[model samples]
Target: MQIVFVGGSTGQGGSPRLYRDELSGDFIVQGYLVTDPSDLAQMKIPDGESVVRVPRSLFDYLPKDDADGVA
Candidate 1:
């Protein structure tokens, strides 16, 4: 599995990760994180950073949306 980071403006920090259902566009291909927040932090990513972390397989993991209906 490869970990990919999705950025905000096309510069440094990535745009916050989008869970499967959070994206109104396309997310059936999403491999969103389903780990503990603290553990996810252990990834050593700098604060305010956002990334799309991939694991061995998405054969058995599904994450809920983190986005609020705040458009």
Candidate 2:
């Protein structure tokens, strides 16, 4: 269940954060449109496919080195 912050869009209002699951290779986005994993349940994604949402605070959990890279 290890999650890693990936990247996000720099759109007008605010940028949404993106995350990736190291174990499942799933992508999670926080902000706008899709706000929760259950939001995609109706999309009928593949059996194991996952597109979820996590707290913005998750960004603070990134490794120090990774955080430096983003800056």
Candidate 3:
């Protein structure tokens, strides 16, 4: 499956980025793992699925329209 870079928040390490699956048009997010007990308890996380935390600023880089012709 082909993947394309979407956007990322500015930082020293430059993490917390978004990516798109070229074939499926599904989004893949890269961010810090949410392992806090209290936070984890609030959500019904299924097996094989983990939560990730990302800064609100990351959404600012998301495209308003279909930019990569994936839609």
Which one is best on TM-score? 3
Error (Å) of candidate 3 at residue 70 is: 5.2
Residue 31 alpha-carbon offset, candidate 1, angstroms: 2.0
Candidate order by TM-score, decreasing, is 3, 2, 1
Which parts of model 1 have CA positions greater than 4 angstroms off? 1-29, 57-71
Per-residue lDDT tens digits of candidate 2, residues 1-71? Answer: 99886765554525467677777766566665554556775687777555554456646644455443332
* Model 3 lDDT tens row, 1-71: 68888888665546798888888877888899999999999999999999999999887766776776444
| Residue ranges of candidate 3 with Cα displaced over 4 Å | 11-14, 66-71
What lDDT would each prediction earn against the true structure? 0.42, 0.60, 0.81
TM-score of each: 0.23, 0.37, 0.80
- Name every residue pair that clashes in candidate 2: none
Q: What are the root-mean-square deviations of the candidates from the true structure over C-alphas?
A: 13.4, 9.6, 2.9
Model 2: per-residue Cα lDDT at residue 44: 74
Q: Between prediction 2 and prediction 3, which has the larger TM-score?
A: 3
Assess the local accuracy of residue 61 in candidate 3 as a C-alpha lDDT between 0 and 100.
Answer: 64
Q: What TM-score would you give candidate 3 relative to the actual structure? A: 0.80
Query: Which has the better lDDT: candidate 1, or candidate 2?
Result: 2
Per-residue lDDT tens digits for candidate 1, residues 10-54, read: 234433333333434334333345467887767777777654555
